[model samples]
Target: MSILETTASILKLMVERQGAIRISDVIHHLGMPKSTASRVMSQLESYGYLEKDEIHGTFLPGPLIMSASHLVNRQLTLNDHVDAALRSLCERTGYTGYISMLDNQEILVLRVIHGRQSLPVVTWPGSRSPAWGTSTGRALLARFTDTQLHDFFASPQVVSQLTGSQQDVSMLVATVARTRDAGYATAVNESVADTASVSCAVGDPATHDAVAFCLSFPQQLATPEELQRIATLLKEAALTIAGKTGDTQVSSPL
Candidate 1:
């Protein structure tokens, strides 16, 4: 889509929903770059077309959307579809489901569903966490090719933005490679001490709309074999969610 078309599409997505939206939402829906989404959103905010919620990290309709005669069209909100998928998975598996999306080097929790077992670590909707340590983060990162992964993690910043080459990209790439081989990703004592998670990436990484379906709980809840079974279910849900979000090009489930 052209820049104008892209901007219009994102704005439409924002106005169509009653709630706020994040840059990650625009990326997921439109397959736009983080830089581009930021730029467009900045422009919209400056023009009074959008308002930012600093605390919640979301965007809402601004003065222009409130008063202008701009066209409002219906489009499937990608985050909505993912959130629903997470809910269904949590119901079936009895595990909390997190709908997470990549926003640069961080993974943002877009939705959260509570299962029977409460997580030892707190994860709230719209919370931002490290992509390097969490299964949800690694699952989304696994979408990148090795070279892309290296470039993505070139900087060792806690945020992991491509800056000074201080990060252990090799190790991250190794973990990602394992995710590629296993058709899923897992974490133990990485995101939070004594917490574990299993994750699967949804849709194509090339789309720039990277998302992951993850189930997190206390570390001792499952053994390797049991975790595999849950991972199987998570992978299936992630795959189905790709089609639901209108992104049929998904990460390989095989």
Candidate 2:
């Protein structure tokens, strides 16, 4: 098939599917070569037509696709004040910072700022990661109620991603509970190996457009005190970002 056909097919799949879309799905569904599928999908992502989950390499609708899919007449604003906040977080902590929103059981990255270190922990604007495993995800997941949390854990993606019989939901519950009490979340080697991150969920959890702020670095480089300090900074940035977005859901730690 021609490039047009491939693009249309991928778009159709994204529009119809409710979950994350990986390149393997495109290869499996379209019988296209891996190179071709990756190229087309990458182009779509670069053009804001498709977004890859940075952590899991899953694909989802990009801002353009989402706007059209949702009947948004205006050009979807991807970043504004949030970019500055992400940059500031990076400068303050010398860790890569992220601005993201809850997308079902994942976090959709809107922006990322690499730290002063030469090795940038880079991820695309539209990439996604499972909520159960990442600092940003856990921070947001902490907002879920008992019923919501239980139902969230039941998702195939969540259950499958969790190791061991820990699908018991109790483990996830405890993690979220800690995030709730602390007003931030931390993860080590959860998504990307050797990476440690601190995150805070900002915005109203009840709102479908909830957002989170995160900072990540190499696990070995972080001490307990440093991570805690970063978390406090992240919470402050979260509050600032949430205030800018008019989302007043973030609360102080217990």
For candidate 2, write residues 90-152 as lDDT tens digits.
Answer: 887678877888776777887778887533246678998777777888888887787888888
Which stretch of 10 consecutive residues in model 1 shows the poorest summed lDDT?
69-78
Clashing pairs in 2: 52-127, 53-128
For model 1, residues 1-254, the per-residue Cα lDDT tens digits are 77668767876786455368999999888788899889988988898878898999898878886555333212435565577777887888778888888776788888778998877876888888778778888887777777767766764555335235355656767888888777788887775788788998766332446678788878898689868988888777776666444344354645
**Candidate 2 — what's its lDDT?**
0.74
Over 4 Å off in model 1, which ranges? 1-75, 156-167, 204-208, 245-254
Query: Clashing pairs in model 1?
Result: 156-167
Clashes of 2: 2
Taken over the whole model, the C-alpha lDDT of each candidate is 0.74, 0.74
RMSD of 1: 14.9
Off by over 4 Å in 2: 1-79, 118-121, 163-168, 204-208, 244-246
What TM-score would each prediction reach against the true structure?
0.62, 0.61
Error of 2 at 150 (Å): 1.4
